[model samples]
Target: MKPFYIDYPQEKIAEHQHAYRCLHCKIPTTIIFGLLENHAKDCAYRIHQGRWTQLEASLKPIQKHFDEPHIDEVD
Candidate 1:
């Protein structure tokens, strides 16, 4: 089976979607499921209808798993 990363169709999403800036990382990112919707339940996000929100508000913790180091050993 393809890994989640492999399964995720980034090219399609990238061509048409906008991403919000991460509150903690200050990097452009999407509001991930479960993390924003559940785990960080108290957090808030400014979901603008027209365009991506600027890094004006220190709103919420968004997913950033791609930047994290792997648990397994790396060569």
Candidate 2:
């Protein structure tokens, strides 16, 4: 899964204030100072992050199957 980055403007960053917007949910949060805060606990985008991990885990078998070498059958 791709990492999520804060999309606050340059001026905001220069002023030490940030407005966090979730790319997936399109929700805008209040202005924050300094360190970045985590997304809302109930945000669907946040929930999807966990799902992405599960999805990758579930795909591991399929990935491995394609990665393994196959031998030709002889009659």
Q: Number of the top candidate by TM-score?
A: 2
Q: TM-score for every candidate vs. truth?
A: 0.16, 0.33
Please write out the lDDT profile of model 2 over residues 3-47, one tens digit for every residue. 543443322223335644454444454432221335556656566
Q: What's the TM for model 1?
A: 0.16
Measured by lDDT, the strongest candidate is 2
Q: Write the per-residue lDDT of candidate 1 for residues 1-75, one digit (tens) a residue.
A: 111211111222344455444453233345443133221333233233111223433354675667666779595
Query: How many backbone collisions does model 2 have?
Result: 0
Model 2 stretches astray by more than 4 angstroms: 5-20, 23-37, 61-75
RMSD of 2: 8.4
List candidate 1 segments past 4 Å from native. Answer: 1-19, 30-75
